[model samples]
Target: MSQSTYTVQGMTCGHCVQSVTEEVGALSGVSHVEVDLPTGLVTITSDSDLSEADVRTAVTEAGYQLAS
Candidate 1:
């Protein structure tokens, strides 16, 4: 398995965490997703390493942005 952590901006509550988790978890090969609301950290585990573009798009679809 491959895992990566990303900082996401604009998440404020449990709903935000759920939204991000759902979106990112939907990506192909993604097996797990964990969000730390206080830290804006999202950790993703997958069958393979995920592309940044894919993660960015997922975050955007969840109504958030990935920290640059």
Candidate 2:
């Protein structure tokens, strides 16, 4: 499995974390997700080879911005 970390922005509370986490976790190959709302840090675990762009897109679609 491959793992990656993304710095997401605009996560102000638990609900934001849950929103991002659920969106990311729903993606194919995304086995797990850990989101730290205070730091806007998002970690993802996937068995398939998911690209960084895919991760970024997922975050974007979840109404958040991802650090470049």
Candidate 3:
């Protein structure tokens, strides 16, 4: 599996983490997702490397922004 960690912005609570987790976890080949609400860090475990655009879109869909 491949792992990638991204910092997200605008996450404030458990709901934020849930939203991010749901969206990112829906990605193809993603096996796991962990969201750290305090640090706005999202760790994704997947079968293959995910693209930035895909991750960005997923974050946006979850009502957040992926830190640049």
Candidate 4:
């Protein structure tokens, strides 16, 4: 499996974490998603490496943005 960590901005609560987790986890190859609220870190594990564009889209769909 491939794992990727991204820094997401605008996440401030459990609901934010849940939103990000749900959105990112919905990706086809994604196997797991973990969001650390305090640090705004999102870790994603998948069957293969996921494209940055896809991850960015998922984060946007969750109403957030990835740190640049």
Could you give candidate 2's per-residue lDDT for residues 11-50 as a string of tens digits?
A: 8888889889988998999999999878898889899878
How would you encode candidate 3's per-residue C-alpha lDDT over 2-49 as one tens digit per residue?
Answer: 999999999998998999999999999999999988899999999999
Which predicted model would earn the best lDDT? Answer: 1
**What is the TM-score of candidate 3?**
0.98
Per-residue error for 22 in candidate 1, Å, reads 0.2
TM-score of 2: 0.91
Instruction: For model 3, give the 10-residue run with minimal summed lDDT.
Output: 33-42
* Residue 28, candidate 1: alpha-carbon lDDT: 100
In Å, residue 68's CA in model 3 sits off its true spot by 1.3
> In order, what lDDT does every prediction score?
0.98, 0.88, 0.96, 0.98
Q: Which ranges of candidate 1 are over 4 A from the true structure?
A: none
Candidate 4 residue-wise lDDT, 1-68, digit = tens: 99999999999999999999999999989999999999999999999999999999999999999999
Estimate the TM-score of every prediction: 0.98, 0.91, 0.98, 0.98
Residue 26 local lDDT, model 1: 100
Sort by TM-score, best first. 1, 4, 3, 2
* Model 2 steric clash total: 0
Q: Give me the displacement of residue 64 in model 2, in angstroms.
A: 0.3
- Candidates sorted by lDDT, best first: 1, 4, 3, 2
Error of 1 at 33 (Å): 0.2
Report the Cα lDDT for residue 66, model 1. 99
Which regions of candidate 3 deviate over 4 angstroms?
none
